[model samples]
Target: MTNYLIDNAGVLIGPVEFPVVPGLGVEIPSNAVRLTQPLEHAKPGHVWVMVDGLPEERVDYRGVVYRTDNGKSLLWREVAELPNTVTAKAWPGTHYYWTGDDWELDQSALAAEKKAQVLLERDTLMQHAQLRIAPLHYAEQLQLITQDEQTALLGWMRYCVELNRLEQSPEFPMNMEWPVPPTVGTP
Candidate 1:
């Protein structure tokens, strides 16, 4: 007969084989239980649990396959599934948090991110518009600007103004209606 040593929580600690004296009955500890089939060595992240007096394998995060003499038997618990969030998987530029029971959007963080993106786009557009207007403005002061150059300068200036006014819109950082930028060198 094969006897398995178990703890108070029924975790299989080790095995005590029978017939230690060849023909004599084995001396088993109080925590040992006899089993019809021999138990194999438990794998990592798994434990041999005694469910209703029957040995069964269960998932154990603690990796408590076997314990030393001074080690304590840990209670087996069923791990609950994690709640699904709006962003199901982790990726770059994505943020999510757990709100006690469910995953919720961090609105403030999203707003801040959106605001930064909008500001970056606006700065780029403003710089482009300013560059296009500089030579045209100087040419106009010298009376050397053509009508097409004057028209292009006005369109670029208007685009810059629109870009600056973007932050004043009601949607602001959340939803922005970006103004159409003028063509590179035409009105």
Candidate 2:
């Protein structure tokens, strides 16, 4: 009932339904091959091949991910187990890097991305610190602030200075020691 047209490599071109030739019954195409027991529909991602003069079914994994030595795309099973190939999910921003033999996380790139995020966080903390410091500095200049207010102002200033010095720490952006803001009501 169903015949498949295939290329020389046995890759399926399309399915064909032949008309009855009256006395001859069905007129199958010369280039078409059919399974011994043909199914109504062919399975997806399957290849039909002539093995030992009979049609055989095999998997077609041309869509599988395979990368060349320089990270260019290529078909899977084309160069499988080859020394210069890296096979892994090639999705964007996954941070997967090819080493000489295997895939690994690119530490330097990861650190750089994390550093940028940390810098943004530091800038935000500094902006919030400045908001608290500006009014206190003005109060001190007018001599209208109490002793408790002076101590609070000094604590906030020290916190600000610590925040500025965060980059000087040996851990820096990678494993930073964030400066805690002074408590509002505590001495």
Candidate 3:
């Protein structure tokens, strides 16, 4: 059974999903506008300062003064083209490298860069945490245990077995064998 109405000529009819008529979406038009479809690159004649590397290493002499990454009041201005009194007062942390032009994205890429740095630091910390290993020994056979060494050798064997069983990966097994070299004992 047909759910949609059709004309006598047998063409399905429906309300238009997109009709063309627009005033403006915002109460006041903003200089900074987000594209409905983002552009691959900044518009022509636009001055864009791309900040990716360490700030200390980057040399930007454009009029745009950037906020230092250290989170202090010490703003970084171009030594050659320092901001005048009025421009310096208005310069914000949001400034990266500025094109003398006014239009820019409301948010910069700085936050994502900072987050990546934090994750790297956390990974370094985890690698420094030591995994404890209990003392152990290697023996050729059960008969090798002497009167005084019997108890010690038995304890070491049990420790190795329990450690391997607890930590071994079923899919990709590790060499859970003791890492140290065994020396010949004095009989």
Q: Global CA lDDT of candidate 3, please?
A: 0.33
Looking at model 3, which ten-residue stretch has the lowest summed lDDT?
A: 128-137
User: What's the CA RMSD for each of the models?
Assistant: 9.8, 6.1, 21.3
lDDT of 2 at 32: 84
In angstroms, the error of model 2 at 116 is 1.8
Give the whole-model CA lDDT for all candidates, comma-separated: 0.69, 0.68, 0.33
Cα displacement (angstroms), candidate 1, residue 23, comes to 14
Q: Candidate 1 on 7-116: residue-level lDDT in tens?
A: 75557876766546656656666788888778887776577878887888875543221122112334323322222322222222245554443345678989999999
TM-score for each candidate, following the candidate numbering: 0.56, 0.62, 0.20
Find the 10 residues in a row with the least total lDDT in model 2.
77-86
lDDT of 2 at 132: 83
| Rank order (by TM-score, best first) | 2, 1, 3
For residue 50, give model 1's deviation from the true position in Å.
4.7
Q: After superposition, how far is residue 181 of candidate 1 from its true place, in Å?
A: 1.3
RMSD of 1: 9.8
